[model samples]
Target chain A: MKPFGRVVICGVGLIGGSFALALKARGLVREVVGIGRTTASLERARELGVIDRFATDWATALDGAELVLLAMPVGQMLGVMQAMAPHLGPDTLVTDAGSTKRDVIEAIYSNLKSHLEQVVPAHPIAGAEKSGPDAARADLYAGRKVVITPLSENRPEAVARVREAWAATGASLHDMSPQEHDRVFAAVSHLPHLLAFALVHEIAGRANAEQLFGFAAGGFRDFTRIASSHPEMWRDISVANRHALLAELDTYITELAWIRALLSQGDGDSLLKLFSEARDAREAWLAGRFDA
Target chain B: MKPFGRVVICGVGLIGGSFALALKARGLVREVVGIGRTTASLERARELGVIDRFATDWATALDGAELVLLAMPVGQMLGVMQAMAPHLGPDTLVTDAGSTKRDVIEAIYSNLKSHLEQVVPAHPIAGAEKSGPDAARADLYAGRKVVITPLSENRPEAVARVREAWAATGASLHDMSPQEHDRVFAAVSHLPHLLAFALVHEIAGRANAEQLFGFAAGGFRDFTRIASSHPEMWRDISVANRHALLAELDTYITELAWIRALLSQGDGDSLLKLFSEARDAREAWLAGRFDA
Candidate 1:
């Protein structure tokens, strides 16, 4: 396969900066040019050796690039894609690293499919509680999973090229429909994050919450670590995936209510039984009995 | 500074067996005897070298023990203490490792104080998700916190002795009233566990929850690790610490309701502000700004 001639990573924050580092370290691309709204991140990415070169000008960064990676927040992916569409090299392979795929896929399919048949929506399931270019690490994608959703309009060559890109980063790949991806993630990724975000907001709003946190043990600290994730990133994911997330939120509330009702009624047996099953399932998952 | 002549560990499960191991390893006690209703665990604890001896007879275990540590289910600590009252050695330092203190302390004060004056109710804030004797580790309490609640009749010498014993195992010690311990723990430890338990239970009860978890990323796995902890242990804790746990549950529910109300009304500004604040506070806490 021909190496990516000049790859452009849009909005080089945590994910983008990491991708930039991975591409440069793996020699997948001869030159990696980063484009972000802010000059600080671009300069930091260059200083940190995440990118071979950096550019604040989108048009200049996209010039002569064979691949364009949308690494901006989900809410801004479309706008970035629109802005860079005019500068698309004749055969540039366009892709994104957004968590939610359906909306982003739709935006690209409707707006850019006429000019490009190389749009492959993908998500690398790798990140930490930290954010920004400084937090990016070259080995972030090692041993991680990357899911790609390709539509009928996507070129087979383009899909294979994206697969090669992720494989070069040492990420295992999976294929699924956009709808299936969103639904599954709503239960596992999106819902859990939303619940954590809400829990933090609730506890922090309490008058004595700070004093309460002073005594916070390891469990609470570990559980709420993700609650500290970037708010704009989470807010976009929540709103972009609103329908499925709302459904998940409703389901969670129902189950919570069931436990609450059992507690209120002093139904020890049911509570015990419910807790036992959950514990058993969780243990199975932890012990590798269940493949989660 | 004489070593404990004999030590009795009730409910020789993970915490109990680990306490036995810690004492035996450090030569803090001459004899470490375990008492539990489960003959299998008692035998296993002895076999694993967690205890020097075993006794199914609670009365026999307590007979000559200078230090009696109740490491049983939170719900059963009171009953066990009452039963062992007649056998408690004179001037014995009685303490417990139950997670919740207010209720346990009240039980000891009301029922066991007539026979023992040095009741130092404590919670060694450590342990793994797994349980039973096989899960016990001698260094389980290393670098962990152990909160002790001293009663009015508690002897200063006894408190110091208990502190030294835990210190031998490298546990940092903290002192608080039973009420303060309970309230603070409700926010930090109890609330997080319940949240995780409830979330896991909720997802489990969903029609597609099993398949959903197959796609669960590392964040979901990390956040819900404690959900895999012993259910019988958590149930007993929730029931025993009902008053405080209930208060925390109420606070959490209120927060959820507030967010739901905002979402329903499409109040993005308020939701964004609340989400942002929570994110900031959590970030600060994770960056080592908090006590945890």
Candidate 2:
């Protein structure tokens, strides 16, 4: 396959750096340019061979780039899009690795109105608790799922180009409306992250938190592992997808209330039945993933 | 050290079977007699060498036994205590491996009033998502924490004997009042289990549950891992630790509500601050455990 002539990655953090490395490893892009505010990070990324070159300004990197990946926090997407709009080539394909798609799509349409057909909103469903260029891996997206929520104004060829680019990273791609994407991710990802954060906060607020934590074992560790994820990134995601996330929060709170009632009422039989169903569902999910 | 002459283990399942294996591996017990309602499980226990002999009745198992370990579901402790009361030797040292302490202590007092000084209540903070004699391991309790909540009526010798037995398995022991044990565990263990169950139930109840689950990756798996735990065991724990668990749940619910309000109000700064605090605390906890 012919490689993209020049690709600019705007954030140069975990996702962006990983994407650069994956593309380089697969020889899918001719030149990779990393753009970020952190000079040290860009220097490290260049030294790690995650990018062919580095730029502090997106405008400089946007020049002559055939592809651009916006991999920053969701809150910064609009500003970056607006800043790069005037410099983007007419044929440049723009896509993002943002967790939320609806707001990103709206930002593209509002900021890059003339280049609306060039934008593709995407989210690679893969990451770790750690962040930064140093954490990037060439296989970060291998065998992972990527959802592409192409805007209505996006040209079919633009969407195909974005899909093909992600495919080169070995990620399987799926398409959904931005609304559908937000709703699904809100239920599965965002809501769980919030719950993990809330759980850790609750434990920390206790008077005997240190002692209680001393006795906590593997279960508590695994359950709260995601609570160690990047707070700024999660905050942006939670705020950008606030409506859908709030809906999920309401549903989860209701489920918890039901459990609380069962516990209070001494309804052991009902609690057992509910727990059994949950176990069965989770076990089945595990089996499916392993088998797949 | 001289080993116990004969040790009887009621409910020869995970905890009981593991205790038997640990004792046998350490030469801490001369013989282990397994007692349970399931004849097949008892047969399996004997075949696995988790027990030296198997019996259908506690009376037969308790005969000539110098130590007795009650390792059954919390809900069944009272009944089992009452049934084995008349057969227990006056010199027999009794200890239970139930998760909750208060109710088990009450059961010991009500059913074995005359033998109160011999009873010690304990909880080994170790387990797998699996159960049965098949899950037994000699090192299951190694490096784990075991909290012993001795009753006021329990003799110092009885507590020491119980502590020594657990120490034989390489578990570090801590002494706490039954109330203190319950409160600490409710915050760290029971509440986390309940939240895992609730999260799984919430996801399972969604209309797009299968699709949502398909996208859930490592975070979801880790967070819901305990939901795959034995439902009956968790149900018993939840019910037995209801008062403490309820208090923890309220605190957790309030924390969640605060998060919900932050999301609703689009307060990204506060959400970021809260998430950072939680991440810092969790990271500190992880660092402590790993570095310790």
Candidate 3:
């Protein structure tokens, strides 16, 4: 694969910073430019060698860029896209690292109507509890999945170029419709995060919270680890994918209510069956992952 | 503390086997006897040197034993207590590794009325995803918390002996009433396990389960890891602590409903507040644990 002449990353956070490092490490781009809201963050990203240069304005950063990766929060993607649409090079390929795809894709089509063919909405399903430049690493996306929702307006070459870029990061690419992507993530990722946050919030509000937390074991720690995620990021995702996420939450609450009823009725046998099926399914999924 | 003359383990699974290993490693027992329903498991425990002798019958295993550890599922505790009541020596100290205390304490009082002074219910808050004798380790209980619920009928010497035994395994011991112990675990441990199981079950039953699991990342894996726990064991705990677990479940469902209403109303500000509070609480709890 030929290296790009110039690559600009918006938002010098974990995902953006990591993509910059990965591209540089693989020699996939000649120059990497970072754009952020704060000079301190951009400076730190430059100091860490995550990017070759920094700019506070996307208009200047995207001027001559061959590719632009919008790694900002979902709530901010629309504004960034609208801002850069005028300055985007005619041949530039644009993509995003937002967790929710439908809203980002819609924002691109509505705001960058003339440049829809250059936009390929992509979400790299990788992150940690920590964020920002310091938490970024070159191998953050290695062996991870990056789902791309290509609109009919996207040129084949443009989608291929974005796929090639993610491939260079060692991430497996999967193409799906925006709706399917939202539904799948809503069930597996978004819903779980919301549940974790809700659980921690409920426990924290209790009068005996300290006692409850003091006796909490490793299971509690692992189960609620995601509760410590970035609040603004998750809030944007939950609101953007509101429909799919709400459906999942309803299903999960119904399941929990069923379990509660079983316990109330002293139906030990049925509870055992429910738990056994779940355990077997989870173990099989783990085994399949290992085999793959 | 002097070493026990003979220690009989009622079940040779993870908890029992690990206890035997910890006792042997600390030289806290002169002889370790393994008892189980299956001869193959008993033989395996003996082959692994987790026990000096093997017996399928607790009657023979309890003979001349100075301490007996009831390390079995909560559902089986009553029957085992009744069966071993006649065989228990007057000077022997009986302690259990049951996760729930109130039910097990009641079982001891009901089944071993004559030997009430010797029984001290205990629970060790340590475990791995794996189980059985093969998973036994000498340091399984190292630095873990073990709660001991001593009854009014229990002799001080018996409670002290049980405490010393757990201390030899490097576990910190705390004394609490059975009701308090059950409520605390119901909130921290049992409710989390049930929620994990419920989440996995809901996803597994979906029509797009394969796609959901395929896209599930590290967050889902950690949040649902406890769903792979022993089904029968969780069922037993859920049923034994039904009242407290049910209360916690209701509280959690209410919390989820609040989140749902916020999402429905597109109240991103409130959602952010809720998630931020949860994130801060979890981070503070983690920091406190490390500092301790």
The best candidate by DockQ is: 3
Which 10 residues in a row give candidate 3 chain B its minimum summed lDDT?
B283-292
DockQ of each: 0.55, 0.65, 0.70
Model 2 ranges with Cα > 4 A deviation: A289-292, B289-292
| Model 1 regions more than 4 Å off | A109-113, A287-292, B264-269
| Candidate 1 residue pairs that clash | none
lDDT of 1 by residue, B1-292 (tens): 5677888888778888888787777777799888878888888888888888888776777776788888987888778877887777667777789988877877887788675467788899885688899988888998788888887776788888888777777788888888888888877777788778887777777677667666676788878877887887788777766677778787777777776676656565676687789888786666667663
Expressed as tens digits, the lDDT of each residue in A1-292 for candidate 3 is 9998789999888999999889889888999999877889899999999989987776779877999999988999888877887788779889899999999988987899999889899999996888999998999999999999998988999999999999999899998999999998999899999989998999999888888888888999999999999999999999999999999898888888888889999999999999999998899888875221
Q: For residues B117-221, could you state the per-residue lDDT of candidate 3 as single tens digits?
A: 988889999866777889888899998899999999889999888999998888899888999999999998999999999988888888777888899899999
Per-residue lDDT tens digits of candidate 2, residues B151-260? 78788988888889989988999889999999988988899899999988878887778888988887788888889898998999999999999999998899989999
Native-referenced Cα lDDT, model 1: 0.79
- Candidate 2, A173-220: lDDT as tens digits: 988989989998898789889989998887887777789889989889
**Shift in Å, residue B65, candidate 2:** 1.6
Candidate 1 displacement at residue B228 in angstroms = 0.8
Root-mean-square deviation per candidate: 2.5, 1.9, 1.4
Residue A119, model 3, lDDT:
89
